[model samples]
Target chain A: MGSTATAKIVALPMVDKHADPEPVETKASAAQMSAAEIQVPEPEPIPTVSLTKVFLGLLGYVTRERMITALLACISIGALFLFWYLGTKYRLEFYIRFKNVPTPYEVYQQLTQVGLSNKYLFNIAMSVRRILLGFMIATIIGVPLGLAIGKYERVRDFFMPVVEIMRPIPAIAWVPMSIMLWPNNEASIVFITFIGAFFPILLNTIHGVHSLDGVLVRAARCLGASEIRLFMNVILPGSLPHIFTGLAVGMGVAWVSLIAAEMISGQFGVGYFTWEAYSLVDYPAIVLGMITIGVLGLACSGIIRMVGVLLMPWLAFAPGGRR
Target chain B: MSMTMTEAETHKGFIDVRDMGVTFGANDNKVVAVDNVSLNVQPGEFVSLIGPSGCGKSTLLSIVAGFVKPTRGEALLDGKAITKPGSDRGVVFQQYSLFPWLSVRKNVEFGLKMAGVEQSKRNTTARALLDLAGLLSFENHYPDQLSGGMKQRIGIVRALATSPQVLLMDEPFGALDTQTRVVMQEILTNIWQQFRISVLFITHDIEESIFLSDRIYVMTARPGRIKAVIKVPLPRPRTAEMTDTPEFMNLVQELKGLIREESLAAMAPEIKDRGLSGFGMKVGPKGVGEIF
Candidate 1:
């Protein structure tokens, strides 16, 4: 067998990359006598750290293509700022009902001044508080309700009709009714925010549960998991990815509802400040409000994403962390 | 060893199915999956059910695993009726059996945890089983990170961690590549030897059934019934080298003939239905004859 294998290797001079290593070693087949003589190569020596390796390690898989896209995004944002400066510098109106738009510098100047004001900070805090309160309540009620609705046909049938009816009504449309229903202005605004947050969370949770593989449930049962155990071990974790997605989407809608409600009836929120600025003809404050809202919303979603990553460590295993 | 051969053959088994039949729907829409199938697995025996597709081999295994109810007959495990799934019977599904959310070790320890076993004992048992599968190094890895063969190995280990009376595998190697499938077969045989538990294996692979089983039960086409039960005369501690010998090849040839006959018969009706779809025309020369 050894002689025949040697003869074959001579006959076939080129490398057979696809050849099974068990029968013949790749680089050392000529030196080997038999399959058992196929030796394992020694592990490569650890080399001193290279700058490129460290750089790549710090930012795994940041392809040149992605960098190009990031650069383009930055350029577009720069052009927007330039256009705002140019437009206000000359007071140019390029149609589309353009008028009295504040210059980028004017907005920046206003932001610098308002950055330290106690009333501005208080308004931001108040808005954050209302949004958090509403969202927390929505999550507590919606997740369990969604799980029940998804798990049982009876719960689904009972709740679905009412949800469907209420789902399509915009949160702003509920402003009049919410004001009448709630005794206080704060309660009305929070109610609107809750309405915005609840439906998406509920629907996504239901979808998450419904879409779980039935085989997992069967596997759990055969493994001796009781019904309650099955729910905890299989159903909960199985549907969590979808639940997080629901939460992220719900957060965005909640902000939109919260801002709208505050504009309509709020006395001391960021939204109310923007509306007050418009009433008092303070144009720079309006742009400041928009910037604040955008920054706050991004931070809110970022926190949710961090929480999701922590909860689902398996799915979010960073490159070079654990393979 | 406690029971006589005759008694084990006729009365008791780790997994026993008696005149089992499962059918879905009613009236015109009805589909008969299994028809009057009966089989038994003695303690420490390895049994394989080989048949054409849609031959109810999986349905039979599901009955034994207590996933599906038998429509016409009954299945029992250790003299107790198999009503619903329990930890007494461990099942390894063909694919996606491992929980994606759990690490390999956690997946293995799941049944132990559910059984209310204490934390330390559960971890030790899971570690031991993972070691048996030669997967102790990959314990922290999620199922998503493992290859097809590795995932199935974890699946088997997870199933065995519960220490069930019988291990029910449903085409566990069907989705694997040819090379991986062969390796998985060897690993399974090794596990079976060490564990010494009854296994009711299901597969369509003729060579696989012959290589792994103490007895191979061949089933007919739809409304599947036992067509033959050939006891493997091959010696224990079977190896890949045995496949080249006349005995193993002869068994493979014999099983292949039986299966091909059933497979052709199974495809014949469907081929005709396809021909009928062409405006009730007769099947031309480009019909079932050319189909493998």
Candidate 2:
């Protein structure tokens, strides 16, 4: 058995020599056979669908689901209007005290009139501008500060106590202090709005930077990444998903605070419009202002979400992100 | 094993670890990870360090890669002491460390990008390496989009991108299934043959060590020290068929015997605490059964 084993070991080189050509010969013959088969006539390619056909297909695809949802929404609105109309017209127990509550028809008339009025447009535009400016200011400061705190333990230790103390105070509570702090009413209102949006952005960004995978950092270091390169390439991009989440939440809070700030201080905004309508006992106009705020908030949040999806195509294409 | 050598003379070995040791913690809590381990890898030679779990094989490799400092002696590459991780010595971890945010091609080109290679050159090098691993089509795919085997292949190609002199692989195929493991081993052998780079591989598999290495270093259990150095006398351009040959089986049996003996020795303390009857018996389907 020992001799046989020795003989096989000695013949291993001969086996390797023979093995090389055997695979090449088989591969060459297989390639030739495949090439010969490729000479046969091919089947006709499937015709491309027309653009109009694709559009119509998409329209059909969306309209079915959307139509059902739209119908359901219309029914819900109709039911709510019917209840309000019956309660207000017949002077029901709850409606007896709610004499200021306008009928659905009156509210609709006010809505159409408000749509044509320049005052309504001015309030919306002013509110949007103030919210945008406040949110931008908050984001610019919050992102960098959060990143620093997350990346450096010394920075975190120094700033964390101050942030923790200030974060939980409501934006409405800031109204008195901001008014005294800022030189003008506009600045104070923006300050309150900034306060509202800042914490969410800061906290989420810190979380994002803190939760970065250690393995990725090590891998980048081994690959010769400098400190700045590591931060820019690994930390920044890795924290993006959380940053986007913060932005969306911040956007919602910005609108809330903008309206609150406008209501408390001298302002021509959606919040002031609602407050003025209430003092004038214009019930239909009050409902109109509420609707306008709702629509504006929805649009702002939607835009933020769209931008987030645009920035992170990878996340958009990930398994759970399927539309 | 030669003790006396002048620092001025050029070393023949690409990586030389001399009496290296690592001790974690301090005073009463001190734990020796590696103890007086010395080894060398000649230029273009493939060497493996195999041992039971917690044998400090990984720590030894880490010291060579410059990620960890040895408390005693030192690890040298090209006769220079390694103090920190550098692109010259590439490491492939058991966990697929490919960045999930980057595409496969970009991950492969990461080291080159860090070295400030021009974009076009990076693209060409990345494409070539991807094509070599038969993953050119997967260049645009993210790490998570690929299978475990494909991710590891990308990891290997990523390490090779900078053209490192020595490749440090720590159980690169340990996470793979058996079939993928075999295929990966073959791919690795092919790449190593072409690159001809010195490699210091750490693994727990005896068969893998024998199959891949020119010399296998078996290490003792924790407080790990080199127990044996066995040479694999197989012919070059090793084929899978060689694994089934009589010579291969004999070498495998011999190595298994050595490993089993060491394993038993490592288990001796536990056996003494539990008693031989409790140590040998294990819960089986029918009832307690003899495990040894």
Candidate 3:
């Protein structure tokens, strides 16, 4: 045991790159010289790290991650085909109806027709543009207000009751009021979409700001951060993850509400096209529209998640480490 | 021991505490954490406050770092009362307090940035301190990517960045395993010698206190008071080998004995007797024997 311990101590200097040789030698010899004459070694100089190494490591990790995601994608595609085949072969009314439900090939034909048209594509683009513009406008208005509500109890109390009454009223419920209020139908859709997003983002921002760790705030204060610096450096950054959560939820709501808002107004959009297809009994085109909405919603949420990854890398290492 | 107080007084005390105490809660429910403890620290002195949990060693250290204000008494540095924390006093918390959001280099640069030190100077100082802590290779790595020991190393470098006049460490290596703890001690000793800054180290580990401090102050539990101050006569830049020395062992034993006594004293029941419990047995009495 004694010999092993000594060997272990001796082995340490080899692995501990931080251990210096000269003073260790002096300490080793000084024990023989006198009891009081011993001195520990100076610390070894730390080694340098190259940025290229970090970049390579990150690249390797990302490649592995992408490979796993690709495998999952293949598995999902297989599952979808199996479900479709089983539904068609069984001829259960649920399955038979699904089979009669335009086949992927039939849907593809209709989608290609609609998707290829510059006018149709332009209408889809306009709907997307309105949703995004309204969402952006809501974020600009809501985030700061949410922060104020979150940080100050008086602000929360002052606005909370009014917000609560407004919150329960659906975005579509606002279409009549918005149409009456705004000068144009375009503005009304934008207004309804903005209302759809504004509450979730605002409420989330308030919660985010309110939920910030008091210890972290105190830590910043102790580090000599002024009030403005503390808000910018600690509060803003800390609350961002919550803000993003709000944005993602809000965008989903905005996308869903935009179709309603567009239908109420009956303009040239994906919603308008779907209503027109239904009037003409063009069921495949209707299905195509629904699929398009679902895909766009998925894409928008994915963008929010990707933005989260870019903006707050720390969120990736949180205890759950899940999106 | 030769006095450095004269030299220290020329610039005023590095840190001065007068009848410092902290109380939490309110009214009848109030609990005192620290009570009427005063200590003067000079520039370049390594002082360790050793005590058990709830003894308020950390509270005392926090007060000195200006993270907390004492209900009574004032914490002064260079004769100036500390109203709030500044770059002049840097703290290393026990649980590896590196900012998880930042890279090792950025964590170290945080203090420099707060102080408004130019980017070039911040880079130079951050690099030097990381090298000193043996974490230079981990400069760009985030805290989560590093091991516990490596994280603590970055924590030390972060605290050291502003060249703080006093370094306050609250059980800085308390979570590390034994072997890593020893290596960290050696690293801290090396850094202390090179920097020559005053340190207020809080620890419950008696042996760790013996290893790193110029003087160790033992504190009693709950509403802490300084029990005794033991001067560590061991020479500077203490090595792991010194831990096996007769003198070092003797000091460790002494601290352990004192700690054992303090623990028993703190745990002793407020009542001298348990009334009728002692009536049956005559070996002594039911409440006679103490923990020590």
For lDDT, the strongest prediction is 1
DockQ rank, highest first? 1, 2, 3
Model 3 over residues B197-290: C-alpha lDDT tens digits? 8889999898899999999989997889998999999986566678899999999999999898777566545323442233342344344464
Model 2: per-residue Cα lDDT over B29-134, one tens digit each: 9999999999999888899998888879999988888788899998999899999888888889998988877889999999999999999999988977776665
Pairs clashing within candidate 3 = none
TM-score of the second chain in each model? 0.90, 0.90, 0.87
- The interface root-mean-square deviations, each candidate in sequence, come to 8.9, 11.9, 9.1
lDDT of each candidate versus the true structure? 0.81, 0.79, 0.77
User: What would the per-residue lDDT of candidate 1 be over residues A1-323, giving only the tens digit for each residue?
Assistant: 35544543453223233222222222232222122233332322222355367668757655766788899999998998888788788888768423688888889899889867999999999999999988998999998899889989999999999999999999989999999999999899999999999989999999999998888988999888887888788888988888988999999999999999999989899899899999999999999998899989999999998998888888754334432
For residues A213-242, could you state the per-residue lDDT of candidate 3 as single tens digits?
765666566566787777777777878989
C-alpha TM-score for every candidate? 0.86, 0.81, 0.81
| C-alpha RMSD values across all candidates | 6.9, 8.8, 6.9
DockQ of candidate model 3: 0.25
User: Model 2, which residues run further than 4 Å from truth?
Assistant: A1-99, A316-323, B1-13, B261-292
* lDDT, residue A167, model 3: 97
